[model samples]
Target: MPRIVLATHNPHKVEEFQAIVAEVRPDLDVVAYDGPEPVEDGVTFAANALIKARAAAAHTGLPALADDSGIAVDVLGGSPGVFSAYWAGHKKDSAANLELLLDQLSDVADPHRTAQFVSVIALVRSDGTEETIEGRWPGRLAVQPAGPGGFGYDPIFVPDGQPADAERTVGEWSAAEKNASSHRSRAFVALAPLLESL
Candidate 1:
């Protein structure tokens, strides 16, 4: 298998990315980076993804992949986009971030509760070549939290234009189901052809 370093220490992300790769490129292996965390000073998702990917490639001397993903709420003007992880503060607490966001949108009506998960995946080769691709899963926020499957704001986000039979929040979906339909999966799908060319 071809091993590619992923620029994150989060075990959940490591697992998710591995699962994503397994479906798209079973011959490829995804490994977590153990290098120092680079400052994600980028203003956009693609820039941030490249920032981390570059750091991982430089540190590990191998091809690296990174994604900058977040929940972009319409009423919030796509806020908590790049800052999703640290929305509440610098501690990166998901619960706190969710609560803070909910409080901010307490008055937001159902129509304006729209949001989408944005993922920008970037690949950085050791030779300095880099590329990025984006994927989005549009939806709206529910009035209350539901489900227990995914992390972040999954419990509160309802996918847009979903069938009545598919009304479950992202957190309610099984791992395999979420992997198949998630923004990250879409992003990986877009990147699959590129990886094959590599």
Candidate 2:
């Protein structure tokens, strides 16, 4: 099996990608990166994903995959996009990030509480072959947080236009359920074909 490094120290991300890839391409192996962290200074998802992937490829001398994802609120004008993790002032506190976002949208009525989760995945090979793909999950923010399964703003985001049973906040979904509809899953689905080709 070909080994690929996922440029992230977050075990959650590693697990998620591992499952995603296994389901998509059992022949490929995705492992967590132990390389030095690269500065994700890029202002866009694709740029940040590339930055990390490039760094991982350079360090491990293997094909690497990286992802940058965040929630972009429609009323907020796509704010907290790239800065989502730091929205509550740099500790990357998931609770605080969710609280801050909810507070900001407190006055924005349901009609305007639109939001979406966006994920960009990048693959960089040792030879510098690079490819990037993106995915999005459209939804609306709840007035208050709910559920307990997911991390980082998942408790308040509900998919729009979903059936009542399917409208649960991301935090309410099981790992398999979330994987079925998550932006990360969507992005990885797109990358499966690309990985096979590589």
Candidate 3:
């Protein structure tokens, strides 16, 4: 089986990508990256994702996959688009990031608190060839965080158009449920065939 590098230092991300890939392309093996993390200086999701994937591909001399994702608030005009992880501070503290965002939108009325989780997945090969795909999870922001299922800003995100039976926040959904329709999951679904062909 061909081993592919999932270019992320976050163990959670590595696990998620591996599981997502295994479900569709069992022939491929996903491995954790053990290389230097690239400086994500890009202004857009695709650019940042490519930066990481290219770095991993160069370091590992193999196919590499990387993701750049964030929550874009409608009211903030996507101020935190590529800066989601550092919204609160540079340390990438999840609780601090979530708390900061909540405080920023504390006074905003429910109707104007629309937002979406954006993910850009980049796949790069050793020869420097690459492909980028995007996925969006549209939803409104909650007044406060809830549940404890997901990471990042999941608790404050109320995924749009969820059935009443389903949980409102991504943090409240089961792993299977979130994986079935998450932004990353959708992006990987589109990127899976490309991996299979590789």
Per-residue alpha-carbon lDDT of model 2 for 1-198, expressed as tens digits?
789999999898998888888888988878789989989999999999999999999999999999999999988899889999999998998889989998898888987999999999999977789999999999999999989888888899898767976578888889887888899999999988888765
Model 1 bad stretches (over 4 Å): none
What is candidate 1's local distance difference test score?
0.91
TM-scores for candidates 1 onward, in order: 0.96, 0.97, 0.96
lDDT of each: 0.91, 0.91, 0.89
Where in model 3 is the C-alpha error above 4 Å?
A: 164-167
- The residue-by-residue lDDT of candidate 3 on 75-177, one tens digit each, is 9998689999999889999899889999999999999999999999999987778999999989998887788898999888999887767647888887777
Candidate 1 Cα deviation (angstroms), residue 196: 1.4
The CA-based lDDT of model 3 is what?
0.89
Spell out the clash pairs found in candidate 1.
Answer: none
lDDT of 1 by residue, 106-139 (tens): 9988888999999999998777889999999999
Q: How high a TM-score does candidate 3 get? A: 0.96
Off by over 4 Å in 2: none
